[model samples]
Target: MTNDDLQFTDDRPITTQAQDLLDRAGFAQRLALAVSSWKNQESLVISLTGGWGSGKTSIKNMTLDHLAAVQGCQVIEFNPWQWAGQDSLSSAFFAEISRVIQREDPSDDDRKLAKLLRSYSRRLNTGASLADGTAKLLPILLASTLATSLLGTLAQGAVAQITWLGVAGASALGSLSLILQRSGAWLGRWAGNLDEDAKDSALTLSQLREKLQKLLSTRDKPLLVVLDDLDRLSAEQMKGIFQLVKAHMDFANVVFLLLFQRETVEQGLWKAGFDGADYLEKIIQVPFSVPAIASSQLENLLFKRLDEILAQEPQLQQRFEQDYWSRVFQRGMRPFFSNLRHVYRYSSTLAFHCRLLRGTEVAEVNAVDLFALECLRIFAPETYTELSKHKALLTGSDPYSRQDEPQRVRTTQLMDQLVSLAPVPHQAATRQLLQEMFPTLDWVFNNTNYDQGIQLRWLVNSRVCCDEVFDRYFEMSIPEQDVPNSLLHELGRRITEPEPFTILLTSQAEDRQAEILQRLIGLVEEFPLDQSVEVVRTLLHAGERVGRKISFTNWSPRQQVTRLLRIYLQRFEQEADRSQSVINAFALTPGLVVVEQLLGADHALRRKGDVGYFDDSGLEQLKSVYMRKLREKADSDPDAFLADGDQASYLYDLNSYSEGGDEGRRWVEANVTSPDRFLQFAQGQVSVRTTHCGGTTTRTSYIPVSSLESFLGLERWTQWAARLDSLELAEDQCRTLALVKEALAQSEQSVTAEESNR
Candidate 1:
């Protein structure tokens, strides 16, 4: 989808039935009816239990929405998470109920109820604790109504940041000490009148409870207090909340609604040295598990989102294969999603990646395969991360030669680990999906093998099974050094049109020219035989213009183009057809070096008596066509021919193709008239060799006397040496000329020795 049409789905709980993707409205409506129909005088506590992200909050909100029309029902939502890591959870609970009661225009009864709540809280805060026969001070800073007010002011002002930690750090040491001293004085006074204070406090609290019960009993509407996300609170906070509910459970015409993930709440309570499940059973009068969303419903919602996104790109929709998607979705994706939250998460992540990759050449990736891979990215992130680093292991073919059993064993172990990252129940499905996407792993899992012939089809179709385009799928864009397949296709289509084709080929940067040529070598393998004649001719023309700039490595632009031509020519099975394609290419374009290199491969194969593309006669005819062109170029502009970028290889080919090196030596002798020209000629005569030393290989270039003698006769070489020696040269020039003369003397010694032996 385009950026304008795309949006990430949020994780908010749905408030109305219309917003519900799963069919939970019926259950929510039934719950609302049950709560509204309650006529008992005793307080009711209902617990909505489910796993996290299982739509408990959504169901709760929808139930509240259904109850909004029922008269005389009030909701007080107290999110315990807001007061997390604080000592004010109990104070905050009563304050919320009092605030909601006071929110209505405060009648005398409402004000009286608020006053009774304050008095009861004060008694509880001032009461002495004797748990385990030890006098332990409670967190009294926020227990009373006056103290809660002070806590609110401090939280909104200077100590706001520290309040979240609930007076539990070195930063609050002084403040906590001052608070303890203030409460300690009150405790001391109470201790002085211990018997009297205890008796009076007990009577006063009993009187307050009776008054509060009578006040709540007269109310026409029942009060519903909702406490959600209870499990998100700390362990102490969860215990405090449950303790608060238990202490206040005797009130009349009041209902408490608590929603949480059961396991999280149980774990939190258990950490605080309480039997969590037993603690919950004591507080919660009635419990209802949030209904599980069906697998089909989740898939429907996911597919609906996917269709909306995929509809924006018509080409991707056309490329989507329904059969493969079904296999992957049923076997691989169905296990991970158990709720609407997962569907939204997967859709949002998929939409973001699709937006980045759309309307670009990288969008040519197979849509079904990308969908499955994106699924893995979300559900099995570790596997996705390692998959990027191990492309060769995933996409590489089984070896044709001897097998390395140890390497295969290692690969099998790694593949098992990757599949094991998924949920245990889905591991088999994950393995099946991986094998379907990457057939190379078939050998590891099922002992199935794939040959190298199918690789071209995979590459041409832009499947992830090919290494060339694998990075684009993960990076969401083409890598800088890699050529885009769109550009490759465009070049192939325009190969017959020489001017535009040459411009396109030469327009790439010097650093990327070698890679671009390498990709084209694969692109040419897919070309049809009918177009080979014109395509080869245009490629030769382009290769002449794109001659060897910063591409001096083994796979230079020239070498790549030569390889491309060989693959393109093999499209024609008959030797005559291949020879004619090469002849026609040379007849239209005058590139001598590239044609010579192309035929050289066949010459080696033919000499070894292997099955080659061309016979001796066909090779000679094609050579004669380029040979005539080379002679004309030498005659017309000899300086330009000698100044070619690959002049060394050209001169070598020239001597080897002509009779006894007469024609090539004449051209060289005429060109080597000056000291600089002779130096250039000598420099071009150097032989390159790679030698291994101390576990590393080094390339050394030196002019060999025998090669120079083979190119130019000894008499001519001596004439040039004497001419250079007679001149008064610079220091560097004399050094260079001396090296040449030293090698020439060695050549003379070898000639003398050979003559004496004869």
Candidate 2:
């Protein structure tokens, strides 16, 4: 393969590689057209615009290559930024062009150019030359004469003084003109003879123009001068180069492909006195924009390239799975793989890791894995810092809305982290964590109205986190006094969680276990309402298995039940209203049974002279009565009992009533057979009541059963029963049942086996 076909493996210069690719890619036709347009004296400037990685430089190099090889075009490519000082930019440009001409064509023309350059060099080196210095200064003499005449014309009887002043001015001008003219002439004469170093130093605006004009006049074929790396140049130097091309070389038969970033070029031109568009029009005869390859196409390109590498190194082929390649391409290439440069960097890093694993048990590289690894290496530090920064930004807000804060902060932090982590070497554990966290963060940020701007500010501040360990630690570590208990609480919460959890665990298994229970408890407390009981149960189980004592000190079983029941009721009511198939299934299950059971008891107790007692045969009738009372209560005043204190007190009273004895357990068991039944019972109990005759009197009733069963599932119910059985016989079981009822009322889903069994 030619150099052009070979992607860069390192940071070496790519001039040769770029040119080869240009030839192979069949870009010669367009290149020649560009050259011809210049030779025809159509336009002096052309812009080679491309997206981040579209081979703009390669095209420029191709034009330069063609000029150097087949076209006999003398091309001088100068990147102004490479030169430190811009004091003599014009001279330096001329010098570079002269060198290129000689380098490309070293014959009779070269000889002529060489002789002229020698004279120029000599003149530049020395103060005087073979020509009489006084005679050579004729332009100054003419200027002085003109000045004297002008002065004499303006004033009478001041001839001598005016003459003297004019003479002085003319002499100064003459000397300046002589120096400039000689410099131009010498540059023209030796335009092709200068070495790279000399060319670099001798480039000047005038000299560059002279060389271009001379090359156009003398060269047989079309000439192309590719001014590349203009983006690297300082604002002033770029402006100067552009001005020289526009003002002096406009009519020359030389095509100048000025390579630069669009933004940089526009900005530079704007900073100069010229109107960007107008100035561009004057110089750029043709403009072409290079767009990024479509994501699908780019992925194909990566696969094709990887296939070639795999073919060459068969052993390396086995390391990666087919899906791995796709994953890596999707993950890394989607966001920032805009150019060949990015492709090269990504591939090279993969190759580097592949090489490291060669000749060992380590097989072919998993592209996705490698990509993630590389991302971590490149981005983890930055991500970590950004997270900290965003956290800080969030901390700065006063009376922050708890609902809005963490999501916003975490999303911003994750985005910044993902961007940073993208270019690192792979570490499986870290990569997995990042993948899970980043996408979650992305979803939150996009779907919700998080403070994106503050997040960005925090991200900018996070640059410091990318430093080495010492720097990162120094920058992110919090002070002892200022550290909030909530922060520790959050971290602990993460440690105990499983998949979809954000806790980062250390490699030491024992260590992970040691603090896990505490973390789990903290997380349960921190996110009790947001997290499912199943999650809390799993955490508790995991902690217990590792010999940790699980505590629900802040976890109110009644409150949890109440929350679950409410959620279930809302869902069931909505489904029932819609008359969905799910509702039919729900009606047949424990939901209808539970609702009927509670409502029956409530009605019997309320009935005049009717004892609230029922035999086995009257169970159905009793349940219907309870259900009716619940419906009545609900229809009475829905909002009155929803108040915080009222609900809490009601839940507490229900807990007490349920602890009355075997009656409570029997009541809960009858009601909570499924999620739906638990919800109905809980909703019935919590619904407020008012007098039927429209009187303003209100009564708060504590329904005996809690809906915890729905929230904790069957397993938790068994566990709570076992625990209660261990405590006080029937009373604890009753209380446990009541709590379960309350939990089921408030939750959206069932809890885990461990919580139920506990």
Candidate 3:
């Protein structure tokens, strides 16, 4: 997919006329009917409640849209939160209502009604708005009058912020009586303007109600003023809005719709010293809460856009199975995101990172890995961090790696806890998917009783699951140089054409060549048996072209070919023909190195004890074939037989010789000439001396010097002691050498005494 497809977009509210998604729940129709039924009500308030992201705003928009289309219906949308921070909720609500009324109902009489509404708001500000600056000025005009009036009660209880710097609060209060005298006649004039009867009056709650009725006389059919986002206001603002609405309603032909989240509104009511239920029931004629989004609807919405992104990846469709789609990817990816915005977050990230990977990185990665990892990265950043930091442990790269004891029992416990960051039902499924994408530290699956094919498929299309790839996916720098698609595809084409494949890789150094081969071998494992064998043949061919500068050092050329075969053999062990073919592949080599390498395959090195991977009979057959090859080489060239018979003969019960009597004598004489070489073989460590000898060089096990002494007879033992004495040795080495030295001296002395007696 292109980068533009992956860019995250702004989450604009779905327009009310944009095909009414709320119709899925039939909320649109139900809410429309409820609003239509309230046509003749004198005054009423309705509340719509739901949690954040539960589509409260959407529902309000839908209701407004429905009402706006009806005959002679005027819908006025008032957002209190837009003005909540700018001034008092009482003044803000009245001002917004004045604006909407003036805009929607602008006839000559409606204009007069708008002017009267503005004047009524000023009266409310004078008596009730504890925070308005206009209210602050009223105390000067009505100080003594307010002492016994409702405005006086509010003035005593409310403390307006009047700084003493300029308008000193004390000085203002001190001249209150004089100011009242001057403003009395002026207040008298303003009172005449406010009252239709032209009587001087104190603006009380009863007076405010009378003023609202005068404003509503010009009201059109069922004026619905929607007050939404009330929950977005502060506690004080919320209280002020509710109080203002309660006082102003009761005028005919006016209806108020108040929208809020239940808990937030309840908390505001409780803080205001009113029982939430009691207070709500008193004002609201009808209360409606939206039902939750259904699982089917949520899934449809979530994956709708994602299907387009996946359409770009046609190869992924063929590589993954139905189980991976339904059982792993779908099951694991769906639970973490339930909302539209969350779905966008996960899908966008997955697309961007997948777009970044190219060449072998893409070819080696699994689709599910990218999908699930991006999901974790968005919804669970901490868990994603764990995956990046502990890739080897999570992916089974280091099989023996684990925390000690109690921790070992729950191998993925930390991951499990991290996995718990997702919902509970998802934990097991997510764990299974991660294990599939990344190899587990322990080959054991986190969840059993589930179908798991080879994990190789998980790495087939991408290495996004690899730690290095995971890190680079987030880097802001330019992409690093990596093996290109041209090279990887060329190598793939020569799967069985070893000559050109080997020639193609000849430029790489031995160590680098082996490393690349290991990667290729792993990548090949993801394919079917025939495809895997084809890739294996090409990888084996690469050994012939590798530089011998460090050839056969760690992964010897012969071992490189055979190591992959051993992996293949274990996987297809039931297919006996494939097993024989692997044996035949080992047999095709022209040199004796293959024999030595194959013979030591079953032995335990420095790592663990012998693992029962290959069949015992198979290993024996491999060993017998290798031994016969060695005998044939010895028969061709006597000096070519450097293998000592004692080590094998101890177990094999054979002599210290090759197959032919002449070669066996020569093999004995060769060891006899340099007994230290024989001594070195017995130690099972690296031999210090350099010589042209073909043998198994990797010593993963160490044997004792005493075992060597017991295994060797008089001629070999005498030669061994002479060399140990002549050679320079460390204190520890001298101690072991001295043991043999003492035995040789005692044998010589006994022989001398026998000669003297004769």
Candidate 4:
């Protein structure tokens, strides 16, 4: 898939005209008809309730769309959650109704009704009705009495001779006068001119409500007001909306439609101190619960989109296996998608990251395994994150690499904790999925272990369970110094073409070259049968140059290339075929170092009592051919042959195997006439020594005195050891000589200690 195909789903509600994947369109239409045909003059409050993300909004939008065709009906939508305070909610609700009336119905009486509605909303917000005024008047009088008593006590403290009772009586009279002046009817009876404006203001709320009801009753069409996202509001705000609908705004010819999650609203209402179910039942004249989407329909929708995404990647299709995918999908991926939003989210995540992986071919991941991991990534993000951090524990790569009894028990506990991060219902399925991907976990779950051979196959396929490729699954990109499997796969295809194959190897960075060669070595087993000889030839040629400089303490580029040859040889069924293929590649190959290493592996295997693809006679023939080739190269250009950095060890091996150790020493002595030659000779003699200190193990490369004596004899070795510091030696030669002298000193001390002990 290309980057252009990478897009994320925003989880937007499906448009009213768009095709409904959840099969709720029919119910929405029927509900719309019921709403539009309602003949009741009293305000009808209809509620559409469901759980969050259960497509309540979509069904509501669709029902409104269907209601649009009704001639005598008008719709007004207000999102109460957008307003923070109760006063704002009440004002915005009435403003929305007034806006609909002014925009849709331009009649003078309807305009007057809209103005009355706004005034009524303002009066309700201000708590200015007669009942509210009377209810608040008693509290004012009580507060006034308490303030006067406190003032009287303070005045007596100022005037020491003043009587507290007499002061309190005068203060009470002043408070009563202020109350009468403010109220005019309750306290202003003796106050002058109880104003007409004050009286009119007191009755304005009742007048507005009666006029609004009369005007709404005369209207031909009912106004349907939709209050959506009610469940998203705070308890107080949501309760205010309910109060505004049930008690305050119950005007004739006006229907209120409330959209929210039932359980959420109920809990919020309960938190506000009331029986939520009873309050909702009293407010709602008609309640409609959103229908539950069918699981099969959701599954079909999810798979159809997944298939569309899969179709963009042909390589993914080729790698896709039906049986394994079916098992993983049913057990692992299927459980995560219960609703339409879940499906969209998973599909978007898969598409976006799959595009990234496809563009890079970072891990050569199996498409099905990637799908399962994405299921965890979306549904169980914590588990996915834990998997990335605990790669060794999950892949069994480290201390738990071998599943002994103790390790198994420990790993089982860790695995149980890991799987428990998923939802409770999905824990079992997630564990099973992990087992299917990582066979190392099988022992913990199934009391069995897969053959170790299968892990090599997993590496070949770039399965995530393979420790080397595990990071790519989580990282979604390649790490530094790692080679792309796409390039390695291309190398396999280009094995027949020497120039392109060489170019591909040369294109990689020096550090990445080793990784590329290593991955190519792993892929050798899967190279086509017809390209076996050519593949072997190409790898040996590449190895001579690519593998020459890459050396670890225990592994050499020579061993790496030889391993590639050996794995490729296994494709041949008969021993004769393997021998013939090796001989054929050696004949076609140009490098002496890689061929010698390949034959050296065979000789070593034979010494270990294994046939090693070449029986006794065939091994001798290949060695003879190798010796002849080496002699020809040496005879043709001795300087170039000696200048070759990696040839020293191979030459020593040839001389020792064909002739004897004495002849090998004579040849080495003759060749070591210059400092450069001696450096090359010393570099070849370098042996890696491993030492463990504290908890760390380290490998140090140094030439040993005993090993030097075996190649150079006692007298010649002594001559070189005596003048080691005097000569102008290179860094590597100097280091080697220092190591040899150190070894000699340690050996002498050891011998003396042994004699003393005896």
Candidate 5:
């Protein structure tokens, strides 16, 4: 068949095997004989059972399809699960059978008979109106009609004998009995609502037996019942179905054919109170298992199906190779033949992808490549990143210090230094440092399988390289036009200010550790900085141990060190409260100039009662005084200061600027000395805004500062102007009055000199 034909057939129900097995004529003959014998004697029960995807439903349909040719026998089909949870199970069951009987034979009398029977069943079950129940003697009416017909023939001088009359009466009774029994059997098949009352009724095995007996009389035809999709029911529901069937085993000439996946059915039964094998023997009169098809046969089937699909769309035929079809078939179709649902799902997915690839340059699809792509889609970026990090750590070189190897001391020292920056416990810090330095080397140490380790190592190495690329992209100060197409570039565009790496590095003193931190911060900010704060904290905690000790004697280097200390302390203070450990760490640094500068600024601002108006020089002087006081305290008694009663209060007073109107603006202008400096400070405090009187007394304020035009150079003015314009305040307002005053003074001096020369 062509591919198009295969696609079309995929939409149709599968019926070729069933039709082939039971040739139409032979099946019809067998059905008629079965129905005839069942009507004559009700002691037989028939069940049709098969595994999922087997033809249980199809066979049942086929049996009913030929029932028209049978004499004195009727066919009725009832699906119990459909009647689930309704109170009157018996009434519903009888109602369905009555409808079916009326439809099969629709004479006026037949319709009346069906209506009477249905009403009778409802009255019996629900204690409802009894008019219909009284009319249920229609079967007796039918028997009397036959008796009258027989007597009428005798009255016409045919000389009918009494023995003949008895035989006829008996035959009529048999037919009526069969009809009534079927109607009753159908009623019993209803899965009664499992309310408290129904639950109690369910436990009464005798009631079920009596109902079953009334429905399936001993002289009636054995009923064939097929239960499909049993796996769809919950364990309790499944148990209910089984219990119902078992309870009525003696009353009905009924055969139950249960269909489901073997494992699902067994598991469900186990959950519902019976052991697997025993439950199967009790409920499933015959269990048929579906075997997995051979890999080659599955391949053939797939190819056949594909051919049919491509027949309508002939262009698709050339898109796949013979081997490709075989591989896909083996991977998706060879696992479980009983699970037709999975088979269809997998095949459909493959077909869809194949259809998508049709007419492309690539002639064949790789199953492994497709599978990997699917897996990647299912997993997330974070998972991949973590896996890569772990791989790098496992395969990388040792990072821990080795006491025996003195020659490796420098490397060990470097490792130790890196580890000290991380805040995690010693072992974790060491591993993290090693991961950063030689990411892929950890896999070797991990003892993973060679292929897995190598693959993981590749991913790890790739991630590390990507991180480095981002760092370099950020580090290089290029014209906005020259920005590299990298993750850092994307991150920079997202942030209104400079990259976090740029901020971290430029905001503090230049040092090796600071530079590393700048890079790390940039990467973290790109994804989610808050989420990665723990990692950054770990790094910083580790790095603190290796830095040089602060000293006041060497003022130049000491100032730089002090600045770094201030930056760290400010960051810690901003991010977290002044914990004893953090405060102690700050006190350990030798120079208090930086800390003093910050505290003095706070005090000066408080003294002025207006933080917004304090100039840069004034703030700097305050910081110096605060730093000096901090140094004095630390020198006098560092341990005592850490445990001091006023430590928290002092830190609070130092950090806190008065919250008066325009205080934030005053602080910005006071602390920032130059245009560039002011801009940086402004960018940091951009979010500062104050409102009063619920919008009635609102005012916008900004710090006034001037740039050193010569220092910026003519070429840089445009960039500076752009930066200035981006601020929340007006561009003209940021120009300081002091600079204008200085310019006027210079102009006056120039005029005086010119006049004298003249």
Candidate 6:
């Protein structure tokens, strides 16, 4: 069973009394001691700074227990992320502050302080919302109403007096009306109220500060309000939290501990248009960075978990025997396991692959190498893709030379380019780990071999880095389709037999052949001797059917892949079948027809002792051995072997011999004796001469041959005539008659010349 089915945790922080990080560097004790010794009413802002996943929350818990138990202080935990999308962090924080400070059966002063602070918090929110406009405008509106009331009373009195003295009061009435109008205009200008607004703004702030002082005076224990996850909030909420803690929330007996990644918090501060560094410095009086987990501590913890996980997987256990291989994995893995969470992330992900690989065709790929690949998948995926797509660079030589040399000098250089192109910022240590893990990629100390190349091919072929892979360990909201585990198990079971393998492979379409070939190749090493033979046989059959495409240095992958499989397979193959081994090698990837033809010609020639039989060299290697026999006979006495070599057309077939196309034909041409026999050899083949259609293309058609060119004579013409006469009357003999006539004319010319000589 694969470790994938086993229960595994994916990098979640430990909340219970988990001794995962066992006080490395005595960090917990030191931090707890520091917070415990703080003086009362100092009102310090201590920043617990660490990168994400570096045990910040654990440290916070340790410090909290220390403060409450030893230091005798009241601790309040404030999570700003809870108010994520809102704009009320100031109100929410003070509410938390009020809840903690207000005792269960509060004394009168305690109740008064809580009430005062609560009221102040509300007014502070209101004044901020209104911009103190209503506070300033209130007194102005009251005074304006009183003045209007006074004016009406005076106007009524004047009108009564004016009615008593009719004509005389008419002149007085005009001046009074003008005075009232001017007075009304003066009151409206006072209603602009700019000056009153400033005074009221100062008063509101002063009143809140007074209430804050009263609240602090009532508290016996110093208030330790711990603010966490400020970095997790949206911009508006983050701004509110920062402003609340930095400016509004400060008080005499309250110490605020802000816990977040400095970089993330600074980014939030940047969005809020505050000078992040300066703002943090002003608010945070004491900055305590989380002690980094040392390499030794990481190794101890990582190995403990790895041992636990790998205990069940015997396949992975095999890797530890090779000292250098084990060291390579450990050294490469060190950079990734910086903390407990990172270790969990890597181990849990690897476990899934380990489970998925068990009893599968690809299980032959070393399990430790698979783990290293998992690390790369998490940290440097683009590099992973490069390794996957271009395995040829690892297997063969001089492939990347033509592909822009300046850019592709060394593997590390290519890696640096790839890492730089990634959107996420990966550490330089990750690049180092990648290079160390894949040592056979290319270097002087890192000389890559065929074995390493084969291992790389497995990594690329596994297709192990995808969303479905991620869902195994990581928590995702959306469910993904599981990998075809049932299908995989069936393939693993069936690949051992030749019939099922052949039938299943051949039935798969051409596109699916490559994937099947990759799976079968991975299984080559893991299989028993008999099964290995079956794989070799099946793959060879496929090759013969598929033929060659995308040529390697000498042959295509059809033969190249077969070459690797058979080379490894032969170790387990029986020596008694060594002769048959060569034949099977030649015949199956579906066996090479070229080798069968060569073997046939060799067998024919050997009966008369003209050539010795070829030994058990593989198809490509044996071609050289086979070629020597043919060349020996041809050089020593070409005429003797020609009768059979001619019958076995492969001897003269250009593809069978190296650089023998023109040379072999020329040898045959030079050694011919009788004109009629040579003419028979040269007959019926079209030699084309064409005009150019383009740079590389040419016009092609058939051209007729002449009698002298074919070396036809009187004997050749007589033979053709006899054969034609023997044929059916309706048979096509026009071309045969034409050649005979030409030969007959040539024979007459020759005879006439000979008679003149007599």
Report each candidate's C-alpha RMSD, comma-separated, in the order given: 10.1, 19.1, 10.6, 5.8, 25.2, 12.9
For model 5, residues 1-758, the per-residue Cα lDDT tens digits are: 44333331232224433442323335434644564554422233344444555445554555555554454255565565676665444566566756865785466545654554454454445442233333455666677677767665665333556656676777777766765675463334332322323533433434543544564563344555445566666777667666655644554454444556567766888998888668767655444443343445544554455454455444334333455334433443233333333334445544554454333322122222232222222222222233333322233323542323452344345445444443332334234424433433333334223353334323222222232222221122222322122332333333322234334334334344333333223233233333233322222233323233333222332233333333333433232321222233333433233343344444556678854222445444444444455446634753454344334333333334333433323323343344555444323222213566854755453322222221232234334445555565445435432233343355456668999999
lDDT of 4 at 555: 51
- lDDT at 121, model 5: 53
C-alpha TM-score for every candidate: 0.73, 0.40, 0.63, 0.81, 0.34, 0.53
Give the number of the best model, judged by lDDT.
Answer: 1
Q: Backbone clashes per model, in order?
A: 0, 88, 13, 2, 51, 11
**Which wins on lDDT, candidate 1 or candidate 2?**
1
Candidate 3 structure quality by residue, lDDT tens digits, 598-649? 4455554313665544455665665566566656654564322334222333
Candidate ranking under lDDT, highest first, comes to 1, 4, 3, 6, 2, 5
Model 3 segments beyond 4 Å from truth?
Answer: 1-5, 125-220, 313-321, 328-338, 357-365, 382-405, 409-493, 503-509, 523-540, 547-554, 566-758
203 Cα displacement, candidate 4 (Å): 7.8
* Candidate 1 C-alpha lDDT tens digits along 583-668: 88778776676787876777778779887777567788887776688778766875676556556666766677777756677778
Model 2 CA lDDT for position 10: 55
Give the runs in model 2 whose Cα sits over 4 Å from its true position: 1-8, 11-24, 36-43, 84-86, 103-107, 113-218, 250-252, 291-297, 304-333, 350-370, 376-381, 384-758
The number of residue pairs in model 5 that clash at the backbone is 51
Which candidate ranks first by TM-score, i.e. highest?
A: 4
lDDT at 453, model 5: 34
Candidate 1 runs further than 4 Å off: 1-8, 69-72, 83-95, 101-181, 184-221, 243-253, 269-285, 303-334, 346-403, 409-511, 525-534, 547-554, 571-585, 610-621, 645-686, 695-758
